[model samples]
Target: MTNVRKGVWRMKRELYKLLLMVLLAILPALSFAQGDPITQARIFVEQKQYEKAIDIYKKLYDQNPTNADVYTEYLNVLIQSKDLKGAEKLVGEQQKMRQHHPLSYVDMGRVYLAAGKDKKAEEQFDEAIKFINGDDLMTQQIANAFSTLGRDDYTLKTYERARDILKNPYFYSGPMSRLYAKSGQIEKAINTLLEAGPGQQGMLEDTKATLLEFLGTDKKNLQQAQKTLVKKINEQPENPYYAELLTWLYTQRDDWDGALLQIEALDERNKENGDRLLEFARYAAKEDKYEYAIKGYDAIIAKGAKLPYYSLAKSEKLGVLFAQLQANYAYKPSDVATVQKEYEAFFAEFPQYYTSESIRDYARLEARYANNPQKAVDLLTKALEQPALRKDIAGRVKLDLGDYYILTGKVWEASLLYSQVDKDFREDLLGEEARFRNAKLAYYRGDFQWAEGQLSVLKASTSELIANDALYLSVLILENITPDSNFVPIRRFAYADLLTFQNKDKEAETLLDSLLTAFPEHPLKDDILMQKAELAEKHREYARALTFLKEIHDKHAEDVLGDDAVFKIADINERYLKQNDEAKKYYELLIVNYPGSTYVQVARNRLAALQTGTPAIP
Candidate 1:
């Protein structure tokens, strides 16, 4: 009997030990599974399981009566469940326990508000603010509690009372600004935000961004901001922020000159190295405000010719002038000569630019505008020999030189250069450019088969310009030629275009007119007129150009190229003819007629500037 009892006892002891080990292993998991009572209550409340949430909150509050979060949640659940009496009793008990607690008063106020007892709620809210005294944590807690209950007035009062108690002037400005904005006192909001000062720059910026979100498109609001910023500038002239803000506001209005004025003053006042002016110049150029762009760059150059940004400014200024001429397609040879002189002076100071895009632009001005293909070829060839030139840059120079070679009738030389660049820069934009040029050379030599083949590959180029040009050329070849045989008219027209490029204009003109007479219904009618218009513009006979453009616009108004004629006519009036009223009318016509044209926005902008009397760049 004793031995059996001993075995049984030992088994019992082992069973107890196993049970204890299992419990030890699962204790952490059990705790994790239970999670936080408050979180569980919140989940139930969010799911609209208010009864379950109330049970959990009651248990939590009973377990920890001093836990403000638990008490607040319990009261909120009671109010949400429409048990107003229960919420009131709970808040009353909390207030009795912590009679002087500001948050207890806030809870009471929330309960009163939930019961539709407005006067009681207001009294409790006042008591809460009174109890807050000067404590930051308590004040913020009460203010947040009031805000949650939609008592924005009380929320503002809470912060204001705290600021007064603490004897701090700017303490409540951040929250007060939002309240002011909500109340439609926008100027008060602006003043409150400015009073916040430096330490709260992030908050200030966030509030400003919020203001801009709603007020950005409202001109009156923008003007209000402008006026306030100007007032601030006058009050504190040394504050760069005000001036910067005013400049930004001007840019938002597309007032590039106004922005330039502010930026110039700031740059001078701060004694900066023209970096700000350089940035403004680029912005003005992007907006097509060439006059303001030139002024901005000139301001930078006026700082000194040896500044870090001077060379860049000089180069970009030339580019802007070139763009102005291109936009209008009207230029005086004297104007071109003047720009070349500027390029010459700039190059004298920075010959290292010989291998850059600036030098290529200068060469293009000579080759295309000044009628000096040899100069373009010589400049690019010398640039190519520069050992320090970037390899990609050297490839670009080769491509450009090939173009000049084509213009000078060195077709074989141009073909060799193009092939070299294509081989060296395979799979790059420069290679695409070279290939496109070679394809054009093929077309110029009356080899449409070879031209179409290369163009088919280039239509998918990543370079937009190359792809667009390739597509345009491809369409011309396909539409003008029969499927089974080469088209003689297209071949002859291509030859004539090459002749025009080579400055053998009389021969080119004869060929074009002969083709027009030979085939009166040919698809190249508008195309031939466009060529003639370009030739007329080249000779500065803008009236003749306008005549040709009008012919296209009047007879072929529905053709694909009609919009080009309209825009060119508008530009000529705007620039060469100085008939701003007529220019405005033409631009408006283009806008109304071709709503989807890519030139519509450009026309609209020009029309606006014309109507507003924004001065054009000389």
Candidate 2:
């Protein structure tokens, strides 16, 4: 009995030890199930709490050294955090766990691609594809991986394989066409699109339009570009852009008649407002059809819609009519006179509506053609009095009045007018013009010394025009005059003349003042007045010159310079001012009143030139 109890006690001790071992195992498993570090890490990783996830993963890795899934999760979390070194170390561990596994290679490739190591990604993808199963999904994944590497050839091959297996070739047609186009094989691209058949014709049309736009500006490439658009236009003849392109092409070739024909065709098809009328007007004007141009202007005016360019067009047409009348002056004097009267009537009707410059032009015509210098001067003077005249116009009128004074042989009067103008607008172009004329007036009176002195100052004038004139006249005076000359008044007049020639008008004017002040009763007073008129002529102040000449005949009729001034008025009106009729009248007057005048021969030659429309020798 004692032996049996000992044996039972030993059995009970061994059973107690086995139960304790089971309890230990169960307690560890229950603890892991309740609080799994790896599960917590995965939850953190999913929530994008990477740092906490990484710490949990590292703790799990230390505890479960042989768990491949834990190693993978840790690596992925490191990769998610962009911890490349940690991810790489985890990848090495994964390789040991699953040698040559497709998932392992793909994961590595994904990591490499994310890191922008494209070559490494490509190598990994290539190795993964070699071991890939031939399932369509697997094949697609491999093909997509090749596309990410930008390996065009491999991508195409993979796509072709997909197409062969899938048997829906159209599925890849669009992408393949784009690829072909990108490779500069446009014809192949077109073929690919056509293979997709009529269902894709809309897409084909879009492609065609894009290609045409790209090639349109290249004339050399245009010939080879397929005329799909022309074909499309023939198929739909009423397309507006097609018609417009054809018209543009005609314009490019300068084929105005052809362009007009196309426009007529367009009009026949539909009566839209097609700018054809304006084009026709421009064409007729180019062909010198003043009457037709008037018709065009009238058409636009009749519309009464206040178009943007209506005023400008009407102005151009009126100008054209005036030009036509002026060109026929020699052959059709009556017609010219009638046209001049019509223009006058037009001005009378719309005097305040036209631009001041246009009104001034009309006045000039009246002066030249209607033998109405007083009327012209009156109009210009009235315009000048109105503060509405532009600065330029005001200056021009002043210059014109000075011209008239010189023309009438009132040289002193003309000089005073020019001086007043110079002072009023000293920095303006008109001021420069006035100064230049004053200097020339001095030169005309045999006052070389005065003219030269004025010219010398004018050489430094602000205007290039004044400076050029000063340089020219200064050189002329220096060459003409002797050094140390003693004829004081004559020298002063000569210098003033030089100033006028050089466009140093203000200085020439001052010299003229000094001369008049120094010798108010000198015998050359009439000569000085005549010189002013001559200066006006040199400066294109014809009307001023005429006024001066007329004054010489009126105020100092018996003086030799007075006779000379009257003859000069006739000569300048005909030759320089382009007032042929006025010139003819002046020449006739000189012949009638001064038969022995020195300008008769030249006047006769000028009369012949005007009658025959040829320039006569001076």
Candidate 3:
């Protein structure tokens, strides 16, 4: 019997030990659950420690009975803890103190709603809405309190009551429209936002932004918005706001023609100096709506050469013509001749443009498209002699002259010109571009070490484009150098890249394919594909280019050229293929997948413009 008693004591000790260990483990969790007083109270409630949470709330309420934040928090804790009587007393005291305030009524209604007393809750909410005066602050507070309680219907009622008291139709339009949209009342949302008068022009942008958020590329919603805008325009014929909104709606639907027509009507009605027309044309040109852009520019030109915008119109029209020609991959020699005639006429009329970007673009046309590098060289050389040319323009022209020299086989002369610009603008973006060109010339000649050295220094350039290029070239060099110093593959690739730059497309393509055929498993495969894509793009073989880009994006997505491939694909779709939706998808993919890419910001901007149907204004 003694041994049995001893065994029983041992068993009891082991059971107590297990129970103590369990408590010790949970004690840390309990302590960790106790954060700030309110957080601790909420955590305790979530853990079903309602009594403890109520005690914390009761203390908090006693410490700051009149504070709204504290009062709301304490009331929420009580309601969540199902302490209905405590919640009633808490809100009742606030009502007695703030007899004119409507939030107290809202709080009481929330408590009643939690208790399933729907009729009582309705009555309390009604009483709160009646307490709304003409005070904007009080009205907003009441509306927000109701919104926070998930009582959107009462929230709408509160805003409507305030609007009636203020006698303003657009008083709560912003919030009310959002509420209506959230509740799937599309027509009401559109109408409520459009109801604002001319006096509310300051809120126009905000109203548009709200519409963008809710309407969001939905075909039916966009159509409804268009109808509402049309109705508003008709009702308020003199209001430019409605007309502008309607034009923007047209753009959102990709209806550039309609947008241009609307802008033309507005300009004519207002008897403006083609300022609005010019702005609209510039936007359209940026969006690749070349036909409408030309029409808009022609409208200004037709206003006569004596007008303020006549010369500007002529100059910009020449640029648009060049851009149109460049965009047309199937453009004929006649197209080039036609645009060249426009440039000659503009330069003949305004010799001052010899110092502008127009001159550089003209030179590019002669050298690149017309295959007359000598003419380009002579043109830029004469432009450089002009005394009125800005220092920067002179530098840019020198760089272009260098490129033309390269095209004309004046390799040493090209080097000299690049070096001159590099020396003159040693601290500018122009200088950086000059340096990159020199390095590229070196790479073309298979001087990899020197080119890599120059590129390494430029890897941190202030210009993002130059820095990205430098980094890419630097990485390519380091990646392709073999252990035994074999340079056959990379040398051929660099030469092919140079050939592509020189517009020898067939030779470049042949060399790239030979490199791929010779070295099937080379690290340069992706780079070769990228070069091939560039060659295809230059030739306007967009579908073929897309196939190559897709290969890189799929096979080398984690490689250095992955984002480049994606961005190039998007660019081709947006610029050459006219596939805006597809472009948006790839841009979005770049943003989501390669957030660190140098192209992310550009991708984001492009994506935003595509999604919002508006270009980002500089």
Task: Name the best candidate (by TM-score).
Answer: 3
Give the winner by lDDT.
Answer: 3
Ordered from best to worst TM-score, the candidate numbers read 3, 1, 2
Off by over 4 Å in 3: 1-43, 55-74, 81-94, 168-170, 183-188, 218-224, 329-334, 445-453, 471-497, 507-533, 540-618
In model 1, what lDDT does residue 514 have? 94
Where does the lowest 10-residue lDDT sum fall in candidate 1? Answer: 195-204
lDDT of 1 by residue, 1-618 (tens): 699999999999999999999999999877876797777789899999999998998888888889877886788789889999989899888889998788777777777877889899888888888886787888888888888888888888888888888876668886787797787777877666665653355554564565575455678767777788899899999876667767877988777778988998899889888988988888888888888899998998887867888888888998998887666555677888888898888888889988788889889988988889999998898898888899888888888888899888899999999999999989888899999999999989988889999999999999978997898788878888777644878988999899998888889989988988987778888888888898887777999999999999999888777898999999888777888888888899899998987789889888888877883433
For model 2, what is the error of residue 289's alpha carbon versus the real structure, in angstroms, after optimal superposition? 9.9
Candidate lDDT values, in order? 0.84, 0.65, 0.88
203-288: candidate 3 lDDT, tens digit per residue: 77787799999999999999999998898888888988889888878988999888988998999999997989999889888887
2 or 3, which is superior by lDDT? 3
TM-score of each prediction: 0.64, 0.36, 0.78
Model 2 lDDT tens row, 117-189: 9799768756665654446676666666566656555555655665666676565666666666566666665
User: Which residue pairs show collisions in model 3?
Assistant: none
Error of 3 at 579 (Å): 11
Instruction: Report the C-alpha displacement of residue 617, candidate 2, in angstroms.
Output: 24
- Models sorted by lDDT, best on top: 3, 1, 2
Candidate 2 Cα lDDT to native: 0.65
